[model samples]
Target: LPAEKMAYLRSLQQKNKRVGMAGDGVNDAPALSQADVSFAMSTGTDVAIETADVTLLHGDISKISYCLSAAKITMNVIRQNLFWAFFYNIIAIPLAAGVFYPIWHISLNPMIAGIAMSLSSVTVVTNSLRLRMLIK
Candidate 1:
């Protein structure tokens, strides 16, 4: 069994950039340990549990899809946060530093800055919460 498993892993490694194995039995222990990421059922054998990197808390395999969706939403929120942070800093910093003062003496008020910062945080949190809607 180990020999066949190793052969399949080798073949998979050759054809895929990344491969993961999920199993819930003692017989699957070695293969689970050998894969890039192993997902073990909460009710799996001790050996399977010990060999896996991720253990499903409720033993529901469907949670894997939910997890992936949440991850995608989290990543998107992070990207949006970064974009907004960079955009605000690039524009606001220069303006607040008086870069435009020579022409119009314009600058962001401290109260406005505080409001904008709070709004940005709210936006990120709201975006992250959208993941709940994605779950089936």
Candidate 2:
């Protein structure tokens, strides 16, 4: 029965699902190994700790919520950064390529183009750093 359950739990990864298992017993080792993210208590058996990706120091479950929240925030920051970076590239590349030169006779200077490129990079980085201000 344990073996069947273990295989069922491990099969989640084959379906392209991100599975997280929290186990402390020796029998939990196999399923924990199969999971993408395994949480084991610091006070768990040695084998459990060895198989887990994350070890709960005080065996506290509340930390799991904090971990999930941090991961969500990180994903949010990544999306925000990607949007601004792509926006900058989409607008700047055409301008730099002299797309406006024929109709408006407006040519982008190489020096100013370099400065603008640098500024966009700085903007993206600064925006990403906003995560540092999030409440812990």
- Report the number of the highest-lDDT candidate: 2
Each model's backbone clash number = 0, 0
C-alpha RMSD for every candidate: 3.2, 3.1
TM-scores, each model vs. reference: 0.68, 0.73
For residues 19-128, write the lDDT of model 1, one tens digit per residue.
67778888888888778777899999989999988888878897766666666777777798788878877887787677888888888787887787788778777776
- Model 1 earns a TM-score of 0.68
Q: Candidate 2 lDDT, tens digit per residue, 1-136?
A: 5586578876776787888888887888888888777889888899999998888887886687777777789889889989998898887788889998898888788889899999988988888788888628
Error of 2 at 64 (Å): 0.4
* Candidate that would win on TM-score: 2
lDDT of each: 0.78, 0.83
Clashing pairs in 2: none
lDDT of 1 at 25: 88
